[model samples]
Target: MPGLDIREIVRAANDRWNAAFNSGDAAAVAALYTSDGTVLPPDHAVVKGTAAIADFWAGFISAGVKDHDIELLDAQDGGDMAYSSGKWWATGLGEDGKALRFEGTIVTIFRRQPDGSWKTCLHTWN
Candidate 1:
């Protein structure tokens, strides 16, 4: 089979990731990963498993997290793998109108599946 384009794949991955986070549904975000995926958030222990990863996002969603923006900085593909690094920022407003801001970079690794779809195998955020 012909190889996937690194740039297009990376763009789609970033878009899907942004959508998942903006949705504020932990399950939705976690669904972007493979079944045995792992995620490392800055200063936090690694989160593994689909269920556990989904649960991890629950807190932010429950707190009404919203408005996430992701900007892709670089991407590369080699063999059966692809990776992308990007910066993201999000804002949240509480019922009392208190504002909160979060900014970070997402570095993700994707593995090509037999079905030709790329799924996240590892993710780390800063």
Candidate 2:
């Protein structure tokens, strides 16, 4: 962690996130998080734990959400914890069977693992 760059964390997490979410595999997306990770989706109740988090993302996938993208704006690390803020977008099919795009900003917190990798511990978007 001496020369640890936040971008490394960003890349590691974001790459897997985009792949899993876009493929509509909610469980894989949840696996990117820590065991007790939490997601605070805007306007929804607080979601904690990987099981609940998988269900949370499953709802979106089931609703036809796809093409998730994250544009990392900034990130910083303090000790074993780090966070990034960025813009995100996704496409979902509406009731009319037309594509609906949603864009927003998100902040994600990560914790360093023993193997020197990073896992998302917290995430929130609006």
Best by TM-score: 2
Off by over 4 Å in 1: 1-4, 93-97
Clashing pairs in 2: none
C-alpha local distance difference test of each model? 0.83, 0.91
Colliding pairs, model 1: none
Model 1 C-alpha lDDT per residue in residues 1-126, reported as the tens digit of each score: 356578788788778877888877778888888999998887788899899889887777777777877788998887689898898888877678899787888888998888888889998887
Off by over 4 Å in 2: 1-4
> What are the TM-scores, per candidate, against the unseen true structure?
0.87, 0.93
* Local error of candidate 2 at residue 71 (angstroms): 0.3
Q: Candidate 2, residues 1-126: lDDT per residue as tens digits?
A: 457578876866898999999998999999999998999998899999999999999999998888999999999988689999999999988889888999999999999899888899999999
Compared with the true structure, model 2 gives a TM-score of 0.93
How many clashes in each structure? 0, 0
- Cα displacement (angstroms), candidate 2, residue 45, comes to 0.7
